[model samples]
Target: MCVVHLLDNPDSWAPASLQGLNLCGECNDQMIADLRLVAARWDDAQEALHAGAGGGGSERHAQRIEAPVPINVSVSDALLVARDNIWSVVLRLVDDHAVQLPVYQDTGSLAEWLSRSQAVKIAGSADKTFTKNAYWWIRDAAGWTVTATHGAETKVDLPDQFCKRPGCNAQLVVVENRAGAHIVQCSADAGHTVQWDTWTNMLKSLGAQKRRGPRLSKKRA
Candidate 1:
């Protein structure tokens, strides 16, 4: 039996695994390659978005100018974008009769799934279901691969140093509200504050911090 690997869900291998598709090795390889192409396209879109958001510039500029604005996309919204991107490629393949696979029962099922908060299981697949905004689908050697791209869970701890504002040496404190929004503020003053509207935004900003290397002066005579 061939195996289908979900790109997003790396941990639960068995759950996304399927069998009895009987696809030939060459056909399976081609399908997997197609799926990877789709993933690459999705990644390229993400990179483009980030670049538009000023992610490709020098570290100093990224920190000074781009740090304030958060991407502000909900997990569900992100998943929708991924689904749309993937479907664009998948639909073409289906139209061309490029590969044989199970027909999707409901054409609008993805939209329905996006609208609802509950998890919905994919048809004819065991131990696999769409939960959160991370779920995705791809054709492979086995049968189908169910995947997810929800942002990884993160733990927020106070930074040792406070205030990114120049000349401020004060310590920082992490303040969170009932809605899960957090702000890192300088204990010395509230004016020097960074607000994170969502946990994902917070994590993104933290992860996007640019590191600087020490500079050496020339010793020319």
Candidate 2:
């Protein structure tokens, strides 16, 4: 049977919760090895980040001059990034080899093919989620600033406020801005400006949580 292994670490592969597929022993071993390789790559990348952070040198100086210093991310974060990247390549492979292989056929051969493929080197979509220019820590300014590359660059001046709207619990952005003034109207929607406060007290009040209805007892007929 095809066994789903949890790709959480590099040492050993654990059986996943769901199970149902006919996979040979060799194929299963190949799948586990491929997953371990991916995990290893992620670990190496994280280690590189940590290694770069050590000591006084050109690299350290450069990092200091750079607005946001890149730090080593967690394994879970790396796993997520690897997962997305791997899936994208897998989907493309499936599309290209549609004629030869069935979509739901044994993934062991497919997994082996993927292991030797160049697509494994591709960076995940989440890799760009936190680019160097996206946001920065300004030591002199004493706060973080969104760079021009960020979608919210224009709204950077807006106070960090949460939406107070009952059902629409999305973050509220500054809809109206008064030049050279602290006063502004904030809302997720331009028309839904139900609350108004100074920039200082904008996030003072918290949004009310929605209460769940009581569970109904089973009727014994």
Candidate 3:
């Protein structure tokens, strides 16, 4: 049985109650609830695949692996649950769990990337890194730098707004703009740039609980 605990200050986005309590805090509870729902669907899909594997042929096995998981998620809910900080954490966790789809990496060209991400929407500023969906929402809100390499020339260009080096306060100056991909130099050393999916996976691994209670009622079973 799913338990719903209402927050004293209602965050409509969060679950009424969560699986545990130790980690329940101010803003992230809603994200935890959303994760639970999504995870439950994934588990159910896996179970169905297992159920269909009795004496199955190779074709059946292949189908199970390739078929889309039957998850009935609402886009609106997904958006609402994925608030500012909450969205980042969930997206990071998803990425960590290797659940991301194929999308272009940050190649320094927000416009070109936005063209590829037509299916998704970008909502926030380009200057500010947003979570999975949000990051794609407002592609041009903040200008990014482009670094490309031509046959013999290295070209770099900057958008109105550029990414600041990870630690250092210096702006990311674009040095090249190639047709396909580009590279830029920053004051700080290069760091691993994680995709939104990878970030979502990290949140899942947090192992934090928003609330706690018996998973099911003895009589319900």
In terms of lDDT, the best-performing candidate is 1
Per-residue C-alpha lDDT of model 3 across residues 1-221, encoded as one tens digit per residue = 11112212133233322233212232133333333333223222223333333332221212213344332122111112212222343344355443453353221122233334421222222221332233322211111111100222242333332344344554333332233433343423222122223223333333233453222111100
How many clashing pairs per prediction, in order?
1, 1, 42
Report the C-alpha displacement of residue 177, candidate 3, in angstroms: 2.2
Any residue pairs clashing in model 2, and if so which?
2-21
Residue-by-residue lDDT tens digits, candidate 1, 90-188? 354345445343344121232222223111122212323321111223331001111112232122445554465788878765544333435444667
lDDT of each: 0.34, 0.29, 0.27
The prediction achieving the highest TM-score against the true structure is 1
Q: How does each model score on TM-score?
A: 0.22, 0.20, 0.20
Tens digit of per-residue lDDT, candidate 2, span 106-153:
222333344444222221112322111111100100010011001121
Which of candidates 1 and 3 is the stronger one according to TM-score?
1
Q: Which is superior by TM-score, 2 or 3? A: 3
lDDT-based ranking: 1, 2, 3
